[model samples]
Target: MMIGLHSAPFLAMVAFVVATLVRGMAIRRATGDRPWAFASAKGVQRIAGSSFALCVAALLVAAALAPANGTNLAVLAAIVSLAGAAIVIVAQMQMGRAWRVGVREGDAPLFVSHGLFRFSRNPIFVGMMLVGLSAAIVSDTWWSWSALVLFVLSCIVQVRIEEAHLEASFGDAYRAFCRQVPRWLGLARSA
Candidate 1:
C-alpha cells in the first residue's frame, strides 16, 4: 500500500479548494451590489482567501510526504469532512440572504435566530474550521495544523470586526442577539 500524494489527502485538498472557490464566487455574486460597512472587510476577505490557499498548499505537501500507513486516521478524516460539509449546507440554507462574508449596512437581511444560528453565531466558520482540521488530521502533518490554527484565528478576528460593524448598523438588536448566542462552539439550551 503506497500512501502518497495520489491518496485520500490530496483528493480531500482538491475537493476543499473547489468547494471553497465555488461557494466564495457565488457569495460574491450574491452580495455584489450591497453597501459594505467597512473597506477593510475586503482586505480581511482577501487575507482569508490567502490563508485557505496556504492550507491547500500545506495539505498537498503533506500528502506528497506522508508515510505509507494503513491507520484509521484516514477514515476519521473522511467522517469529519462529511460532517463539516453537512454543517456548511445547513448553515447556508438557514442564512439565505444573510449568508454573507462581510458587513453590510443597507437594510440587510434580518438577523436569523433559527436553525444553525440558534446554536452558533458563526456556524459557517465552525464548519470551515472543522474541514481544515480534518484535512490536517488526514495529512498527519504538524504544519497542516498550523495552517488550520492560523485560519481559525483569522476568522475570529474577522468575526469580531464584523460583530462591531453589525452592532453599529443594527443597533440594540444585534447586541441582544450576540448576548444570547455563543461566538464559536454551540452550547446547549439553558432550559
Candidate 2:
C-alpha cells in the first residue's frame, strides 16, 4: 500500500497548509472597520463566505489524504496554485492594510486601482480560485471536486455581494475601474 508523507495526497495536504498559513497571515494583517469579518459576514454573503471555510477543510481532508492517485499533471497544477497564492499575497500586500475578508458594510477605505488590482477588479478572488482548483486537481477525488464547486459557488456569491458594496461605496470611480479591468484576468482581451 502506497501511504506515507512522500505520497501525492501528502503533497496536497502540505499545499493546503501552506496556502492557509499564507492566507491567514494576509487576513491577520488586514486593517479597516472589521466589525463583521470576524463576527459575521452579513446576510447571504454570510452563508457564502462561511462555505469557503467548510470547503477548504473538506478539500484538505479529502484531497490531501485520499489514495495517492495524483499524477505529474496534478503536481504541476499544485505548483501553479501555490504560485498563484503567492501572487495573491503580493496583490493583497499592494492593498496594504486596506484588506478585509468579506464586504465591510459602511467602510469605504480605498478603491485600489494600482498593482495587481489593475489586472482584475478582484485579483484576490482569482488567486483564491486558483488555489482551490489546485487543491481539487491534486486531490483527484470526487470530494475534492465537490469542494471546488462549492468554492466557485461561494466565490460567485461573494463577488456579487462585494460588487454591490463597492458600487455603493466608490460609486462612479469603481464603475470606471470595473469597465477598464476584467472580472478575472486578461485585461487586454477584456478591453
Candidate 3:
C-alpha cells in the first residue's frame, strides 16, 4: 500500500488545519471572547456541528493514511484544496474580530457583508466543504468519500442553524442580506 504520510498534499492539508486553529485562537484572544462556542449549541445544532468536526477529523486521517491516486484528477484535487484553504483564510480575515467557530449567544456580532460575504452567505462553510470534497477526491478511499458526504450534510444543517440565529438577532437586516446573497457562492438572484 502506498503511504501518503510523506506526501506534499497531505502536509498541505495539515498546515491548513493548523493555520485555521491558530487564527481562531488569535481571534478569541484579541476579542477577549469565546469564539469557539459550539459547546453552547443545543439539540440538532450541536449534533450537526459535532458531526462536521468528526468528519473533518476523519478526512484528515484518511488523507494521511490513504494512498493518493496520483492521477491528473488528484493534482486537480490538490489545487482545489489549496484554493479552499485560501478561501478559509480570506473569509476569516475579512471577518476579523468577529470570526467565530460557533454561534456566540447573548452577543450579536457585526453583520458582515463585505468581501467574500458579498457572494456567499457562508464562505467559510463553502471553503470547508471544498476542502472535504478535495480530500475525498484525492484520497480515493471509500471511507474518505463517505466522510465527505457526511461533512456536507452536517455543514448544511449547521449553516441553517446559524442562519436562524442570525435572522433572530438581526431580523430584517439579515433577511435583506439573504435576499441579496445566495447561501452558497453565485450571482445574487433578482432581489
Each candidate's TM vs. the true structure? 0.73, 0.80, 0.90
Over 1-191, each residue of candidate 2 has an lDDT whose tens digit, in order, gives: 66532244345445545654565576555532442363466679778978987886786676556555446766666576666666667776677656667766776577777888878878877877776777676656787898889988988888888889889998998887888888888663344
* Candidate 1 residue lDDT tens string, 1-191: 66542255555555655654566567668777342333334566567656655765765676555565556886776667666666776786676666655664454566677888887888877876776666677666678778778877777776876677777778888877887888886663563
**47, model 3: CA deviation in Å?**
0.6
Q: Which residue runs of candidate 3 sit more than 4 Å off their true CA positions?
A: 1-9
Best by lDDT: 3
Pairs clashing within candidate 3 = none
Off by over 4 Å in 1: 1-49, 56-69, 104-107, 188-191
In candidate 3 the C-alpha lDDT for residue 25 amounts to 85
Q: Give each model's clash number.
A: 0, 0, 0
Query: For model 3, how does the per-residue alpha-carbon lDDT over 1-191 read when each residue is reduced to its tens digit?
Result: 55542243465567667877888789777778777778788888789888988998998887676564567777777787777878887888898777777786665677688999998999988887777777787677899999999999998898887888889999999999999999999977676
Our model 3 lands, by Cα RMSD against the true structure, at 2.5
Q: Considering only N, C-alpha and C atoms within 3 Å, which residue pairs clash in candidate 1?
A: none
Whole-model lDDT, model 3 = 0.79
Report lDDT (CA) for all predictions. 0.66, 0.69, 0.79
- What is the overall TM-score of model 1 with all chains considered together? 0.73
Superposition error at 85 for model 1 (Å): 1.6
lDDT of 1 at 90: 72
lDDT of 3 at 120: 96
